[model samples]
Target: MPVNVYRNESLVQMETYEAEPARVDELVEQVRAKWSLLREHGYAGDYPIEVLRGNRNGGNIKVVEVFRWKSVQDRINAQTDPDYVALAGQISSLTTAEGTKETYTQAVRGFNHNFPSVGGVELLKGVCSCLLTIDGVVKDYQMSVKNGIVLMHRSPRMDLDGDGRNEMYLKILMHGGEIIQAALGPIRVEQNFNRPNDGIVKSNSAGGSDFPGTAIWRVSWKIHTPMGPVLTDPDQPLIFGPATVNHYPPVGTHFHSPTGPVALVHEETGARVGTLTPGELTAFDIVVTKDDEIYADVLNTPPADIFEVMEEWRNRMGDQEVQPVVAGATDGVM
Candidate 1:
């Protein structure tokens, strides 16, 4: 029957019924009497501690405190009485002093902040530059503000180097911890990405609505297919960007394809030459030649089909090689 109560919810009280300690029961009584004192004068935090139990034990009083916002530890420490020791010896005569322990477990909870808008631009720029341009992490990721505009770029950190950091993001918050916005982009990259990428550049057409450049610059895009160093077909697409030769994202150009997803390089020296797997052939097995000079794809390619239809773009360098890189097995159909 001895219990402290709080009506706001279930209850956060020091339960003694489950314990065995006569001295503690008495301490409970003395604690109740003391709490009654704090309650009468109204201490602080506008919250009052309610004493629901009062009994004799170990020559002391057993008690518990009830309140809102005030923590359980506060109540336990509040147990201060000069009379406890003398009273404890007296209570032990009636019942043997047993054992009890103070056990505690704390909890933590939280949520995410809204995406930043204005200052976020600069924040995102910094994040991308630090992660990508600075060369920290090895993985690459794209960064852009989403009021619905592609505004930033952050390449993977690890892909750029042998270093072991990931291109990550950080949220900017006020002194009070209220998050104001986000800073996102690549960081810690070992290599500089100078590949021709214009889809990510924002701009209008050369003759269309001019934004800021003397000529039309660029805009972001989602390339529908994969790209290669070259396509056998003269009709294949090239990098889609402002053409010193022409302007616009034409369908059959390298620029017209998606941004670099995979990397290609010389097999021996580990030098990157912008070679890539033709889209749809990611699973083909690879074998490095004994000379350590070139990577010989282990997977087999399709049999020569002089009679079978050949895609002009793929046959050259677009995707499918006219001769099989692997033997007679056609894998990763696209």
Candidate 2:
């Protein structure tokens, strides 16, 4: 058996058959044999090909076969091969022609693989827009990310489609508490928002120099980190240092931590950039070529020079002083 890994050519095909009641057992065996043949000829991926059986209307048998093609050329090669063609003819004969269906789709990252933990972060390695397309069909879906934060968590393993196999789940937490969940199967694709392109990246925040009071907005900024959820003081607004413009050299901005202990986390992926203990100042640098958000959590109580706790909330709640981000900067890409 080949080592389980995602195929580079992520094309997957799903075939559904409504078999005649009399030929249910034979059809299921034939489907398994077909997958075995495909794997023998290097036409199938290393992952397991699923042969799911169910009861259809009128006591007929519903058989669904899902498999990944090793490459686009391998899929085309199977269409005309003599042995494959003969098996396909046998399968067609077993199933009702009118009830047969097939679909082709591409898998993104986080499909057919399990994460080590329940919740972490996975940044978009490349650009993938909100609009998803499969086999020339444009899906009506949109997942936009503001401030480059994408929360991800895993759902409990269960048989979502009654396919007889418990599927691993990857759930993406979106803005406004909306969640996009996908099964770790061939057709399921994870939505990643990692592009800084002009058309895709949008800014919905608007402000002006109107005659508004300075302390209009004072809600505490809640930042989710690897340690846990850190909430800043509502009375004292989170202070942001001046942005360092990177135009000439085109390098990411350098960031330094406060004079006390804290933890630095990437806002997009939730990956820990670095940690700082007492008397440690340097944490990590912002490495994005475009605008992004990073947060710092004060691990312990520090001197007033670095960060101080609120009087009212501190007295009642005790020491829960988590400092806001030390660096929230934007850099230009050449």
Candidate 3:
């Protein structure tokens, strides 16, 4: 058995199965029945199975079944067991052809943060997003964050499609608060094609601006199914930073704690950027926010860094000195 571990935790093994559209339902039933038998035969740990319908292609429906086991040894033993063998044989008979299986281990960081608690059902509750392009039109669908949970899997870098380059899986929260997972590739088109002429052109001349232009690579999101790139929904908005008022300036952004908002400010000028809402912010924004607050406060003045402003507010609130009143005559005398 091949087992891979990261930082002392054994990676969870995932097995994916694809089958013809007509036989997917039947195959799922068969797998569940086999699972029941495996439990009776002393399969004690929690094992989750998901059935997803891939976009239809060439009259074939792609069905994906994912299985997450506690350990690679457990997976190997279960597959080689007599009962499992019989079940596999029965499942193969119903498929149009032999389904493919791939094994994957979960990253320790991703697993610990996402599925920290018991129960496999928690995996489906995390926020997810789906980006799809159909007929040359691209759109993004965001799933709402529920119970403060985000991402079924932390951005695990892996070669999910067996391509030479690695891809990152992003879980987007859908409009109905459901999960729609998508894969993002990091490699640029020019690099992937290996053609120097195909790459993006760079300019070295300074354009007299404080912020110089730099090349940034962006990846298009694709639906995580065997079916060849089908659009899921076109109406949903792309998942970005905190939701802000439509007319709000995009200069500054805010950070949030359990108590309330923490305004992000400029490092040198200490000018307020924008305010963040009550949810998770983007990775890029988080980095910027941390970088801005690394310096100490000069004085308790206007345009101070957010932390300094907060500290000043707390100090004023704690100081409670009574003001002296002028002496006055008794009753109506002034």
Candidate 3 lDDT by residue in tens digits, 1-334 = 1112232323333334566667778877887776676566655245455666665565655656655555556666887789889987998887666777765533332111111111111122223222122121212222223332221121222332342332222222211222323432211110111111000101112232111111111111222223232221122111122112111011122111122222323233444432211222222111111111222222111121222323333344344321211212321111
- lDDT per model vs. reference: 0.24, 0.38, 0.32
In candidate 1, how many Å is residue 34 off?
3.1
**TM-score to native of every candidate shown:** 0.16, 0.33, 0.30
Q: Against the true structure, whose TM-score is highest?
A: 2
Cα shift from native, residue 71, model 2 (Å): 0.6
- How far in Å is the alpha carbon of 83 misplaced in model 2? 0.8
User: Candidate 2 — which residues are off by over 4 angstroms?
Assistant: 1-10, 98-101, 108-334
**Is candidate 1 or 2 superior in lDDT?**
2
Residue pairs with clashing backbones, model 2: none
By lDDT, who's the top model here? Answer: 2
- Clash statistics: count for each candidate: 65, 0, 13
**What does each candidate score in C-alpha RMSD?**
25.5, 20.5, 23.1
Q: List, residue by residue over 1-334, the lDDT tens digit for candidate 2.
A: 1122232334677888887788989999988989899999889876578888888667777888888888888988988888998998888888876445465453322321221212223322221112211111222223222333333232233333343433223233331112231311112222222311000000111232111111000111233432343322222332211112222110122211122323433345555443222110110111222211322122111223221222232243333332322321321110
The order of the candidates by TM-score, greatest first, is 2, 3, 1
What would the per-residue lDDT of candidate 1 be over residues 1-334, giving only the tens digit for each residue? 1111211331233333222354555555654554454344332123445555454554444444454324444444344433444443343443333423233343221211211111111111111110011012222222211212112221111111112211111111100001111222211111112221211212223333222211111211111111212111111222211211111111111222222233433333444433222211110111110121232222111122210211222233443222212212322111
Error of 2 at 57 (Å): 4.0
Model 1, position 164: C-alpha lDDT score = 27
